[model samples]
Target: MPKKVVAETERRRRRPTRQGTVLSEKLIVQTALRMLREHGSAGLTARRLGAALGADPSTLYRYFAGLDGLTRAIGEELMGRALDSWTPTGTWRADLRSLGLAIHASYLAHPQAALLTASRVTGRPREIEVDETILGILRDAGFDDIDAVGTYHAFIDLALAFAALDAGALAINDDVREADEDMWTSTYAHLPPETHPHITATAHLLADRMNHSAYPAVLDTLLNSAEARLAGREG
Candidate 1:
């Protein structure tokens, strides 16, 4: 089916459940996000979602085609939230940095949901808006068509890659995550400096930094490279 037709069908319904809970696309998407957070991805089944909304499982088809559609909706919601309070700052690098951080922060807020949807393209309204905004920033920053497209792809892919990696770490169960974290100190730190000279020497620094996200540093590097490319093209 065509995308507009699908969108129209999804939006054409808003009904009250037997228990009087009003059901709309926004409500369902928000509830689904909550479900993913509280119950994890595996727990967000049709039956559970229906029960949470006081509706029949089949009722969700009125708003979303299936689990995949709902997943995309949830992804769109994440994208929307990221851009909710953000506006372009006119400086391309600064604006891109802010937008990148916002998206990463939003995904990490719901790691389980992010695990399912962070890397997928929804092609929905907010997702399109984000892409357009990025392209606009690049074009306005004096990048020509080829450079703008290339840099836009790199910037978005880099941000999403780190978001997925960080969210995956956050999605691990608490006990296991703690044990994994402790390995930096308890395992690597204790390695003999003779056989494992480099790791042992930098073990303290590794442990201190391992717990933090590298998105910001990586983002700066990417922007710097893009800036250099722009300058080279001008020269």
Candidate 2:
């Protein structure tokens, strides 16, 4: 065996597919992601995954213990992609904002996967690294342990919550998604001023703004609230 193949074999137990194609964890996760994108959440099954990979369904057990384990692995892959190219700039608030956007974008890229795993706690390597990075940023910015933990919890949960919400919207089929988008302009904007004065008065503004994700604004608010709390502690 080539040294590379030997290393892979040592790193993970492998089995050749029915076509004699070798399999690894990375390949499986990537295949699973593609399946999710092509078929939506319902399309990802061990048997289907096996057929896609040209491997026996039983072969998957050696890699992921079960479907739940595989789901977490997929979630970890998203986390890995989010942080892969990002480097902190030492400004805690700005760094956090960047991180939040990156995470949200990654989840949005695979909305079905995000819908499945956004709120999950994988405890996998990439997920652990992300958690540590957030906590480290807060600690470096002078948050005490308690405040750091609390703020980190709030920050991550808020980001994932928005990711789930936005991804769910995106995951809807095209016609429904378009209709939902159009509702802001068609339905909300055209409400009669006499019966619904408030909505009618601001209908134009609401139509203009209602189509975008509120994650950025919500993230800013959370960061600003944390900053206020930290400043109060110092004074």
Candidate 3:
């Protein structure tokens, strides 16, 4: 009986065992996006990701080349997710608004990934689609082909630059609001009244206008500038 039990145990140990399959590429991206939402850029490393996914660090390389590639994949995933809900309304203004806000919200929601990927020019598939949409919006908004391309060049560049800056600020633990508070309360508190009279006097008002309000206001400013330049060229 003891010999039979020992033989059975050996057979069980030798039998082909199935542990759960390692995570897939899409699964890794999804989990990484979640981790990015919870922790900032410093939290996202291959080792950390591997730990979170219950796999060895090297397992991730089968899916993503490295953290930079992972970051790019995250960016593309963000764009893909954002575009899933985004449909063009045929009106250029509406289309532009949707595209800009969608990209902003998507990146900001994963601020860590945003900080890593926002400034990068991925030229990924979804990014090309985004560029196409921007050009289409410009053309729809009464721009000729040349005007469309030029306006697209300006609009996308400005929007992406702003997105990167804003996301970078927002990613670092309320640094955006905290820094503004410091600037107003601490930095401006001791400045001499005579030489810096303007800032000292108007600092209170400046404080109120710099919140989420800046997004729409900056967008308006960019659109206005682009429109004015188009007018100049046409004139």
Candidate 4:
């Protein structure tokens, strides 16, 4: 069947279930995200999703092509949320910083979803919009095409990479996460200064800071580099 025909047919089939739950792509994605948060990535199977929605597992195919397609939708939803929260200021440095933090915080807020979707390249609407917005910000700030593209690429990759990295830390079981966090204070902070002089010297700082996500600091560094490049170009 033609893709559009299939989509139309699917739309026609949308209806309320016995529980009065209306089935739609948005509902499914939202339900899936909730499941992921409560049960982690491994728990978002079709059967479980259908059970949560009070629908047949097969009914999901009407809205999404398959599990992969549904997963992409989930990814796009997160991106859409991040984009929605941001209002760009004309100041490139502040705008990029705000955007970067919003994206990072959005992912961190849903660590389970971030673990599954942060590394994905959905190439969907929100993802495309974010790319365009970043490029526009850089270009408007006097970056040439090459510079804008390069900066966009780096900025996005850094944001997502840090999201995935931090989400991994957050998505671990509570007990495991506590153990990991405790290790900074218990193990690293108590290492022998004779052999681990550098670590011992800064153990207090490390104990204070290591448990936190480094995304904010790293973001500032990247933005600084981009600003320097732009300044050099104008000079």
What are the TM-scores, per candidate, against the unseen true structure? Answer: 0.93, 0.93, 0.76, 0.94
Per residue, candidate 4 scores C-alpha lDDT tens digits across 1-235 of: 2123156344644568767877778889999999999999899998999899888887777777778888998989988899999998799999999999999988888999998888899988888998899999999899999999998889999999999999998888889999999998899988999999999999999989988888889889999999999999999
CA lDDT, candidate 2, residue 13: 42
Candidate 3, residues 1-235, lDDT tens digits: the string is 0112122223222322134444566778888988887876778888988878777776666565577767888888877766776888886766777777777777777767777777777667887788877886787677788878876776666666667777767766676568775776677656788899988887677666644436666777767776776678678
- Each candidate: what lDDT? 0.88, 0.88, 0.71, 0.88
Pitting candidate 2 against candidate 3, the one with the higher lDDT is 2
Tens-digit per-residue lDDT, 28-94, candidate 1: 8899989998989999998999999888787677677688889999999898999996887789989
Candidate 1 clashing pairs, residues 3+ apart or interchain: none
Give the poorly placed runs of model 3, Cα more than 4 Å off: 1-22, 174-179, 185-192, 211-213, 228-235
RMSD of each: 2.5, 4.3, 9.7, 2.0
Q: Using TM-score as the measure, which candidate wins? A: 4
Tens digits of per-residue lDDT for model 2, 1-235? 1122234466454556676767888999999999999998799998999999987676677677677778999999999999995778999999999998999899999999999999899989999999999999999999999999999999999889999999999899989999998998889888888899999988888878787999999999999999999999999
Clashes of each: 0, 0, 0, 0
Candidate 4, pairs of clashing residues: none
Better of 2 and 3 by TM-score: 2
